[model samples]
Target: MFIRIVKMGFNPENIDAFLENFEANKAKIRNFEGCQFLELYRDKNNTNQFFTYSYWEDEEALENYRNSNLFKGLWANTKLYFNQKPEAWSVNKIAEAQNKKPAL
Candidate 1:
């Protein structure tokens, strides 16, 4: 699986606008092809900073979304509210674990 994380810093005054836009598009984005999970995180110390954490089936899946019209439109509106240029990272998960009860 592939993971994509995007960090965005929005202008304090425009944070509300950003949230509104995100709210309108979150469902569509989560339902996009090859998307496994989607989450939004807010910086603990900075109310204006947020991150989007998502999981995709593969790099190709991510690229397809990036090239889609949905992304184009969402990003166009989102960039207008940015206080600083956004940063993104694409990574592969190396390990994960969950506790399980012993079989009887």
Candidate 2:
């Protein structure tokens, strides 16, 4: 499995617009072929900084999504609001731990 992490910094005033766009398109993104999971996170100290953590089946799957028109449109809308250039990393999982105990 592979993970894609994107770090984005938006101008405080533009956050709402970015969020609206994400809210409208997140479901489509999550349901895209080969997408295992998707999540968004914010830096506590820097409210305007955010990250998207996504899991994919493999590099090929990731590239497929990146090459799709969906990504091009999303990127076009998202990039304009950035306070600084976005950073991204594609990585393999090294370790993970999850509880298997039943919920109490």
lDDT of 1 by residue, 1-104 (tens): 88999999999999989999999999999999989999999999998999999999999888899999999999999999999999999988999898999999
Candidate 2 error regions (>4 Å): 99-104
TM agreement with the true structure for every prediction: 0.92, 0.92
So what's the TM-score on candidate 1?
0.92
For model 1, name the residue pairs that clash.
none
